[model samples]
Target chain A: MPKAPAGTLYRGREGMWSWVAHRITGVLVFFFLFAHVLDTALIRVSPTSYDKVIGTYKNPIVNVMEVGLVAAVVYHALNGIRIMLIDFWEKGPRYQKQMLYVELALFVILVVPDAYFSLEHTVRTIFGST
Target chain B: MTATVDGAGRPVIEAPRSRAPRPGRARARSNFELYAWVFMRVSGLALIVLVFGHLFIMNVLDGGVQRINWGFVAGRYASPFWRLWDLTMLLLAELHGTNGLRTVINDYAERPQSRFWLKMMLYTSAFLVVTLGTLVIFTFDPNISG
Candidate 1:
């Protein structure tokens, strides 16, 4: 007999980590976006001040935070898309595991390069290369 | 698009009969509903992967936290590749999430007008974000132009 994976909900369709993660990321992205809007709007106050504020965003730590921000937005968006498709299924409930595999593949394809570009850009700029 | 019957073509959106069917057939067995049911499952499954992979990478990867900035963003967006990557992610997420929410609204909202206006607001918001986000990603200038 196949052994069950740890952290299995013992009762649920698909992964519970995904569901909780989706909801949390959705809320987090929304809140962060609101703050981002406020920060961005600061440009209206004056360019230099705004740029200075924007300068703060250049900090690697802040950039790392953005990785989190982007991740949240990405996850929420992808899962939400997945959920939408499932809702359209003729028999989605029957093929959930297969769908899970598909979604995981899609996720990997999207995030890896996202993180890579983020790092590449940071490294290039820190070393003073375009 | 229109469905053709006999020698005539009729719009699918147009009713076969304006008044609809008898009480027993009001909710006829339908593939329309079946499609929507399937859409939710498929989208849900996609969301699971898109959402979790995003989390693990951002929150759990190298340094486990703390390593980002404008230069980081600028470096990536400087390339057309990252720009496209971002654009795809943005479009997919906005469309998927909003569409998912749209399904929820359709399921819950009873009144036609209520549904219409709610959807109006939701779509409006979604469109605004998609447009603005795309613009920001493409037109982004790290050098600050006045």
Candidate 2:
């Protein structure tokens, strides 16, 4: 196959990058859900086992990872809407780039507050309150 | 317009404009893929609500994960509303993720054998998760002593 030229409109632009981000975040969230369901299942074994496992989630490292997980879910959710619009709405294809910008703006708007709330206890645990 | 002469003086035949099968014809193809496409969008809208609600409650509210424990689990499960909410979320999220991974596998796994095995594994995991989760939700005994 012949090498394609660089800087194509669709190849390296917002559309392509958003698609890549959506797929990556989606897979991350899916795998996390698998583990999450299993962990929650531990409650059926015994409360002691459940609490012991869940307690590990409270530590600083996993707390940060929780924030990351939430971020991934948020991004995937927002972009999934964008994808629906691009499919269902008549003008959505024309304005996909604009929609992506809207999606990103909404992502930051939602995730920042979520991260703050999610990490507040961890932050307090790591560093004393003022 | 059915036929035109090419540069080589050979005739090019056009396919029938209406490719729909005639009445009484056996239709070999179904709208499975079309339904799958629509399912993704519909389930995605539902999951946005279910998943974000779950994230808000479990990860962002009232000291977040720090306060989650077996007692917290029991308290939430005590209510029928929360139990149904969790059950719906679990089923929808698992199915949505399974379909999404199926698409990814179809896209990337070029080898037929690899694709078949990957999808088999994906389906098995999905089945296990759905069954285990449903059982746990229904069979949870909050009063058990260990």
Candidate 3:
């Protein structure tokens, strides 16, 4: 008989979710870094080109995506510290679930305010025109 | 080992289940993985401060993104302190994120060919971005007007 379909590893536990989120956020941050570098480099070609590229970022779509970027950075940073603890601290693996909870709680506290600030800016930028 | 012939006439050695090695400690290799792990932690800690400060200055302070123009970038790049700061952030973030994805690809891609190709692509892109970014940081000139 064929083996059963592979179950999702992320469904296992808090640790699994943390692992999944770390990878997801890592990719997100990587892509952002790529674009950021490319756009910032436009300054070498010409200031007009640089301004034009960055000017596009003021649009509502890019504004929303900025929030996603912030979320990814926040989660990755938190989980990165957790991973370090797990690697170095003898008791870290044992209390990983508790650590994950703390990470999540902190994620919420940090992200909510950041989201508010980002959305507030975006809204103000989009609708604040005379 | 029991030998069997398939329809394709290929011999297969069927080792008994009892011979399977149980998962336990990983065999030691070079200290590369250890160093990579430590780099991720150290770079990540530094990135938290560098990245957030960058975001705050660019997007929150003063007039925010609206204030970012050619002149602003030119002025910032003129300062050696900001130049060094940005260069460090660029290198640390690129290396840390690249290593993180390397771990992800290793875990998810079971096929050897897939793993090799994916890593090749990842590394190439990482290299290109780092090179281009570094060049931009050091070579940027404010006097080059359109």
Best by lDDT: 2
How well does candidate 3 score on lDDT at residue B92? 95
Off by over 4 Å in 2: A1-10, B1-27
Winner on lDDT between 2 and 3 is 2
Tell me the TM-score of model 3. Answer: 0.82
**Candidate 3 CAPRI assessment class:** acceptable
2 against 3, candidate with superior TM-score:
2
lDDT of 2 by residue, B26-131 (tens): 6677887889888888989999998888888988888888899999999999998999999999998899899999999987787889989999999999999999
Q: Encode model 3's per-residue lDDT on A16-109: one tens digit a residue.
A: 8788788888888898898899998898999889889998777678877777788888888888889888988999999889999999899899
Arranged by DockQ with the best first, the candidates are 2, 3, 1
Best by TM-score: 2
lDDT of 1 by residue, B1-146 (tens): 35544345543454565675676676758787667555545555654555455445434455322343344445655799767755665566566556556766775687888889989988887777777777777667767645
DockQ of each: 0.09, 0.56, 0.46
lDDT of 1 by residue, A2-116 (tens): 2445775345546666676766776566446435545544433445655567666557777667666766666666666666556557776666567777877877787676666
With candidate 2 superimposed using the best TM-score fit, by how many Å does residue B12's alpha carbon deviate from the native? 26
The backbone clash count of each candidate, in order, is: 42, 0, 0
DockQ score of the complex predicted as candidate 3 = 0.46
- lDDT, model 1, position B139: 64
